[model samples]
Target chain A: MDFVNLGRTGLKVSRICLGCMSYGDPNRGMHSWTLDEAASRPFIQRALELGINFFDTANMYSLGSSEEIVGRAIRDFTKRDEIVIATKVFFPLNPNDPNSGGLSRKAILREIDASLKRLGTDYVDLYQIHRLDPNTPIEETLEALHDVVKAGKARYLGASSMHAWQFTRRSIWRTCMAGRGLSACSRITT
Target chain B: MLPLCAAEGVGVIPWSPLARGRLARPWQSATTTRTENDQFGKGLYGATEEADRRIVDRVSEIAQSRGVPMAQVALAWMLSKRPITAPIIGATKPQHLDDAVKALDVKLTAEEIEKLEEFYVPHAIAGFK
Candidate 1:
């Protein structure tokens, strides 16, 4: 497998990242066609054998079971430091709970811990927002993510499945913040 | 997304380069797990199925002449784009994985690439919903 640095970061990842959306208990999640642990293990093992060290999953995938399966599979087959694991947040985990979704400070802080616990890891290589949350202020989301990086919970921040203009707005905001001489992931009380 | 990502040096990883099996199979009988499960995909590609078939037909023609699977030719066409870092292929079987890896070797000419793209009309963005 070919290796490439993710974004501008020094994190080297395999060109082929094994997406774990399909690995989890089919009975426990939104997707009816997901694979159980028994069926998912071989695919994870095969991907590792093929020299793919990068794996991506999300907290909401299979209702958190995907993270569990992926974590167990990686631990069983490879060393912790040898692979790059990416998981996403921002989706609602509980429909009854108002605090369960979006990129708000409360949600990001809560979800990262929940994800790390499920993944059986102290830190994730990358933590991403699963989608854009229009309800939450972008600054709050960024600051919360910055806190995650500062606390050593995640090595990098990423966003997924958003419009180009949305991404551009976030990117521009980040640049402006940087230009103001703010440190990476500094605490913002907003 | 491709050009903007290229300009920013952000690696572009494309999902569903085969349009969730739409490009791999004949348009009339097209149906996959995604088409069945994902209403978003149905709305995205299903409406353009007739127009997109022109591109898929070209891909099928190339694949038949070169003795490669249709999926490989389609994947090769995606790989031919410079800004793409990797095409994230969803493989259920080992053979699916093998075919995807082989797509790296199926080279297409400039003319073939142009012919394949000639019929593609823009549609509403999918995948971000």
Candidate 2:
């Protein structure tokens, strides 16, 4: 597989990133057609054999069973340093809890720890906001993400699926913050 | 979007580059296991299947002439576009991955690309929501 630099980061990821959205238990509430852990292992192993070192998943995928399956497969097949793990946050893990979702500082702090534990890793290479959280202030979200980086839970930050203007504003805010010698968002995408 | 990504040096990773197997075998939507199981793909491509069929037919023609799988042709077309760093392929079978890896070699001519694109009609974007 071909390797390319992921944006401006020092990380070199395989061009063909294995998306783990399909790797979860079907019994989970997310979707009816997901592959179970046993069914998912061969696909992950094949991807590794094909030289794919990048994998993407989300905390809410199959209620976080996707992360668990991916983590177990990666640990069994490859070394920790040999791969780049990317997972997303910003969605409600528990619908009953009002504070369980969004880009709020409290949610970010709570979710990252849960994701890290599920992935069986000390840190993730890229921690992304799964969607735009209109309820939370952008600055507050960035500050929380910066704290994630500072606390060594994640190395970089990413955003996904927002209006162009909102994304531009977020990108500009991050750049300005970085210029002023503060933590900033690393990428705006999707 | 391609131009902006290029100027910013951002790598574009195209998910569902095969359109969830629609481009590979457009007619297979009626019976394909993936299409049956993929509610997202059904809503996204199945709604516009008629419009996209013409594009799929052209891809099939090109693949026939080149002696390659339709998935390879579709993937090669995406790779030919500007600012695409990678096309994330959903390979359920080992052969699917093999087809994707070989797509890097199936370069389409200008005429072939124009033929494949001429019949495409835009519809609502899916899979993001």
Candidate 3:
């Protein structure tokens, strides 16, 4: 698969990112971006045929069930290292469980471990903050993310669906901004 | 422009880069007229007969002169813009992709671009943020 740097990070992903919002379940009402497990194989097979190696998924997407499916599908089917998997953290898995979500230091640390277990991977290529946490200090989020990178749990970090605008609409400038979040996903695009 | 985008390293994937099957014949939507915002809106064809006819004619002329699909002319214009990393083309069916790929190699000159732009210049396009 052809690789391109994702944003400013040294980490590179396929130019064609397969979006997996279509891969996990049927209740397409709450977070409609998903595909059921049964339909995931051919979808993945086709993507591989097209040289698509990067995928995107988030915890908020089907509340983490999507992550499990992506992790299991890839591990059980394709060669692990050839394809890159990314999933996100943020939205609550259980709305009633307040401590379960957000970007607080505690939330990020705990969620990263949970995401690691769910993803069934020792280290993520790009660990992203699914969304910025207003409740937690940016320093804490950055440090937590930095710590993960230092510990080797996550290889690098990236962000998505961000509202933060880059001044140069033309240049692919790579800056280590202080305020931002990261998310991960594994694509099975049709 | 492609050089500019390349210089800036801005990756661009133009959505509806070909105006949703409007560039090709056996034109998919048959209502002839659709809500401007509906996926198959005739806004591309022209708001009025005179206007739409002009749009089609401009595309048709360039398409014929270039000896390629009109959609190719459009994609070529974009690829001409170069630094475009990719185009997020929507494919309702397989032919949609087949049709879009046609424009990959058609490079439009500066004059042709200006002419095509003029054809639809009068349309009161709406809703941009």
Candidate 4:
């Protein structure tokens, strides 16, 4: 696989990233089509064999089973430091708890630790917000993510599936904050 | 979004570059277990299906002409864009991953790229907030 720098960061990632949303327990989450752990391991191993070093998963994927499966497979298939593992927050693991999701400082702080535990890793290569939280101020989310990087829980910060203007707003806010801008941003252009 | 990301040097890892597998096959040719149950994927398209179908048709034509899986054509089109760092590919089968990796080598000519993108209409922002 061809490796390239992830944006301006020195971190090199493969051109093809294995999305782990499909490698979860089907019975555990809303996606009934997800592969079980046994069926998923060979694919992860195959990806490693193909030289794909980047893997992306979300906390809400299979209600966290995706991360567990990805974590275990990565551990068995390759060295932790040799690959880039990315996970996201924002979706609530429990719908009953108001603070269980979003980009609020409290939610982010709690979710990061939970994700780390599920992934069986101390620090994720990249931590992302699954979506833009309309309720939270941009500054609050950016600051909390900055703190996540500061705390060494994640090497980089990212955001996914937001409007371009919203992303520009966040980027401008980060520019003002200086050294707090996101290193990556994901979008779905259907 | 691509321009802004290019200017800011933020890596753009787009999700669903295959449009939830819509671009990877003939227009509405078949539905998988995911398509049958993916409510989220359902919400992502349909608003512009009339227009999107033309694009899918073009992808099919190109794939057929090149003797490759439709996925390689779809992913090759995405990889041609300068701002894209990597397109996150979800694979349930082994060949799915193999097809994605092979897409890097399936270079689209300038004319082919234009043909693939010519039918794109601005979709109502789907996927997330």
Q: Which structure among the candidates has the greatest lDDT?
A: 4
Which residue pairs collide, candidate 1?
none
lDDT value, residue A160 of candidate 1: 69
Tell me which residue pairs clash in candidate 4: none
TM-score of each: 0.88, 0.89, 0.59, 0.97
Q: Write the per-residue lDDT of candidate 4 for residues A1-190, one digit (tens) a residue.
A: 8988888888899999999999899998789989999999999999999999999999999999999999999888899999899999999999999999999999999999999999999999999999989999988988899899899999988889888888888788777878656878888543
Worst 10 residues of 2 chain A by lDDT: A179-188
| Per-residue lDDT of model 2, residues A121-162, tens digit only | 999987888787889998898888888888999876665555
Query: Which residue ranges in model 4 land beyond 4 Å of their true spot?
Result: A188-190
DockQ of each: 0.33, 0.36, 0.11, 0.73
What tens-digit string does per-residue lDDT give for candidate 3 at A39-125? 565665666566666656666666666677677877876776877776666666777878878777777778888877877888666
- Off-target runs (Cα >4 Å) in candidate 3 are A7-9, A165-190, B1-129
lDDT tens string, model 1, A144-190? Answer: 88888889999877666666666666667657766211111100111
Candidate 4 chain B, run of 10 with poorest lDDT: B120-129
Q: Could you give the CAPRI-style class of model 3?
A: incorrect
User: Can you write out model 4's per-residue Cα lDDT over B1-129, one digit (the tens) per residue?
Assistant: 888888999998988888888988898889899889999899988688899999899999999999999999999888888778999999888799999999999999999999988988788888774
**What DockQ number belongs to candidate 3?**
0.11
Model 1 stretches astray by more than 4 angstroms = A177-190, B28-34
Error of 3 at A88 (Å): 1.7
Model 3: how far is B112 from its true place, Å?
8.3
